[model samples]
Target: MPTGKLEWGRILGRLSPYTIQKGFRYLKHFGFKEFWIRLHERFEPEEIPYGPWYEEYRPDPEELEKQRKRKWKNPPKISIAVPAYQTPEKFLRQMMDSVLEQTYENWELCIVNASPKDASMEYILREYSRKDERIRWKKLEENKGIAENTNEALAMTTGDYVGLLDHDDLLAPNALYEVASALEREPDTEVIYTDEDKVRGEELEHFQPHLKPDFSPDLLRSNNYICHFFVVKKSILEKTGGFRRDYDGAQDYDFIFRCTEKAEKICHIPEILYHWRTHESSTADNPESKLYAFEAGKRAIEDNLKRSGLTGTVTQTKDYGFYRVKYPVIGTPLVSIIIPNKDAREDLEKCITSILGRSIYSNYEILIVENNSTSQEIFDYYRQLSENPKIRLLRWKKEFNYSAINNYAASKAKGEYLLFLNNDTEVITSDWIEEMLGFCQREDTGVVGAKLYYGNNTIQHAGTVIGIGGIAGHMFVDMPRERSGYMHKASIIQDLSAVTAACMMMKRQVFEAVQGFEETLSVAFNDVDLCLRVRELGYLVVYDPYVELYHYESKSRGAEDNKEKIRRFQTEIEFMRCRWEKLLKEGDPYYNKNLSLAKWNYSLRPKD
Candidate 1:
């Protein structure tokens, strides 16, 4: 139960007088039910929790001392940039003090006081600057936009790297130390970001941490997940031209996208180093207050796409800042739909019927491998389905092996792309193939999986996480569909470590390149193993919620009922552990280590 920023966050603001006021605001905007549900979910305890986890994980006095004395051949100084505009005296003092208390010494605080008329602001800035020679400030003639104000601050930096800091936010004492340490490991790193949590009210109680994954391009295209504690090598900052006033509201988003586009090595420190202060007017507190920012974010993603020689239509989703990018089908390339079936006539019938009847992307073929089905009706149905020119049936006379069966069919596949679908599923989205194909068509993407729901409209598989339930399990399992489900994760497009093969789409070459699925993995974890290998080859495994489907997998099909079945399942588990030992032990890079691995929900890490 560690922290929740399921997009960048879900349960964002901590409970406080201000938070309660915001709750009433939500009640007015969303009516009573949605607000009530949100409040109720906050108390629904999960396997891991955040508050205790942070305290346990946070570096103590001894660790801080070690960091202070840590040797370096040539330590890099990080310049802290702050653009102050009528900032409250309380907030200004806390922000300055946070920098002064840094365990890492060789850093400077660069501030641009845009509020020149506010004499008290000048006095506080003068006092702090006098106290520490490292602290410096410049007063502007008049308040320029945020972008220009930041540029003034950026102009003052002489450090090797420049980090963005809001005037009212706090920084962990080890924040600079962590940045310097990561830079040591990756000396060539251009862009570095750290995980962040929200601090609210007079107490500044940290809540709803945004524990981020490793640098994900697709996830950044969705939302500014690299929002806080972001530092860029000085060269990249100069190259990206700092920031633009055109994207004033979301200047950081625009700047981040540009910096990442040019960055050779982007490093992420999973520890929560940044504290985002949430107030009524702050973007961290209220999304609607900054529609202009979200709109600017859309433009940012669009520009990034254009710069990469890729084209996509970007649109903001219902979730305030989260977006959706529709990548165009490159050239209507052929897709081969590969489905492995056994003696399940009804399931096979529905599956085949849905794809043939619903899929709008018509340039495709279906490779249905009949894997030793005992039923006569299944054979009859296969015969009927084969009548369609696009549908081809191949017989797998050998005993049931999910990997082998798919491999046999894949060998016979003619199309460029391979979509492995399960018989227990029905297509929900009309353009599901095109949706999956959009991401699959990307050169860097190796596999794409669909969002699956049970017949009851609860989520079955949004994505797959390694080290969950002792192997890998579908994330957001059985969560209600209507709810945004942790930072609108159920709706946004992002990269994942693995996805269920039930409805996975990938390039045929990628499948062949990875040597197809591991035949040794007979049934369980075969898909996960395939994805893990695909990822090993340095290709992205994407989870596209836009490609929706209903999976009728039996919920009651819990554990193997007999000893032989149980033994086979255990072997599969053992095989996954043995083969992908590093990923299992180190945890999924696409998933934050601070989050829970015990449950489907991205709960906080559990208490010891």
Candidate 2:
């Protein structure tokens, strides 16, 4: 691993001129918040301060031993396949040892030697095979690529499930044990994957963890987040015909996409079961070392899209591994922009003006849900705004129930799509409406949310993460706006459990299907409640970072610091718990259980 000083220097050296330019823009627009966060991030990128949950998930040897003895009703034998091509002696031994040390004894380690000339690898494989009956070894006649080599290993496996293992990687001692446990619970699970982290340098310090979500098809299209600790039913693997040679660099990704399409049930084990070794040649250490991998990844996504009958153009982003799928608007449907405001005329005007001035989408209307604004200035501004044919003012005489207000406004909306936008948010992206509409109009998508920044250009809500702050909270909150978050999640377009109502767009049919937002959640967590309810109906809630906005967060409603507001907030929290207790306790499907629930960003749960 690089030393602290050396790592800091490298980080500085990689800082692009574009980042510096964005920094200056943020300083001018948002003031000191962006500057302060940038400085703090530069110094302490990995040292994120987390709450009690950080200490709660420490690995326990006693627990592992207990799990080892636990009886399973139906524990399927797992066949782990490793395609070796001149693998290092140390790494090769470690890989073999990790499988041999599995707590679940019903597993076979299938090692296929692609490099027949590598005497050291052959000797080690033969020695290990002789020592353990479960260890299977096969020497190839000639050296094929990773795809063909792995396929050869797959043919030798007889287990119910076939697992993929890297030649230079290490699995947690209890990795196969966890896989068996999950299968015992859900026997029909066709595909299973786990979170992973990188083993850096000679010291093998664990870092750069990829705490992945459950089965997310959209997220899979963005990038192969399920790159390691991957297991699939042998039947499913056969149906997919293993990996393709054309996508050799991204063979796993292509194979996974194909398998998932035919999979009946997909399961995710939220544990760091795999440690990806980051050597100089490894993609984890330097992505640029194999640019062909990214090109293959892009092709994988594009092929998946074509197979799924979705019309989209897949292209690589500046972030090497990440991709952007641009789905064209299906039709020119009228999108109603629903703004619920009380008194902030200036904020409301700014939001409306930005939409009118910057938006390229032609078919849209603005609905101002007037919730008892007392100011004469606000009334005057409303009267002037109502002059436009596209704008209309609706009155809500009752109390400030966010759900009730939006529900009332949605009922009166004439557009095919309803966009529940906050009055305090200003549009940053010129094609923000078009970008959101494309996703919302999709048959599978439920709700679409935009990336929001604070007045200081720090992230306010990249997306909503369930179980954060004990209920749900905005993801990547307070991070510098320009930075791509963990695994480029903050910048990529993907499926999430929930998204903030601050700038949410959805089709009229979807809104009606979920019956709009829950009125019981009057103030706090109403958006989350609505999103959860929407997800319950089997539709995906997406968070698109391409649609950018500046949200002077809650500038109209003010803070929840006062006594009455705090009481109401607490009541709403209880209401959400009472309503969606299963989702909260079991974990968000769009988030991993191993991640810290206390922090908004994807921080690792610290060991005690």
Relative to the unseen true structure, what is the C-alpha lDDT of residue 389 in candidate 2, on a scale of 0 to 100? 93
Model 1 sits at a Cα RMSD from the real structure of 3.4
Model 2 clash pairs?
none
In model 1, what is the error at residue 550, expressed in angstroms?
1.2
Per-residue CA lDDT of candidate 2, range 1-608, in tens? 00123255756785667546545654664458655544444345464432233224434778878878888777899999989998989999988998887788899999899988989988999899999999999999998898999999999999999999999999988899889988988899999999887786577777666788888888888888988999999999999988889998899999999999999999999887898998657887656667899999999999998888898888887655789988899879999999999999899989999999999998999999999889999999998997999999999999899999999999999999999999999999999888888888788998999899999989999998889989999988887788767777888998999999999998899899889888988888889988988888999999999999999978678899899999998999889899989988898888887677878777765564
Give lDDT per model, in order.
0.87, 0.86
Q: Each model's TM-score, in the order given?
A: 0.94, 0.91
In model 1, how large is the Cα lDDT of residue 246?
91
**Residue-by-residue lDDT tens digits, candidate 1, 302-403:** 999989888799998755678999998888888988888777888878888899888899999988887777778888887788789999988889977889
lDDT of 2: 0.86
- Which portions of model 1 miss their true places by more than 4 Å? 1-49, 554-559
Cα error, candidate 2, residue 94 (Å): 1.5
> What value does the lDDT take at residue 514 in candidate 2?
85
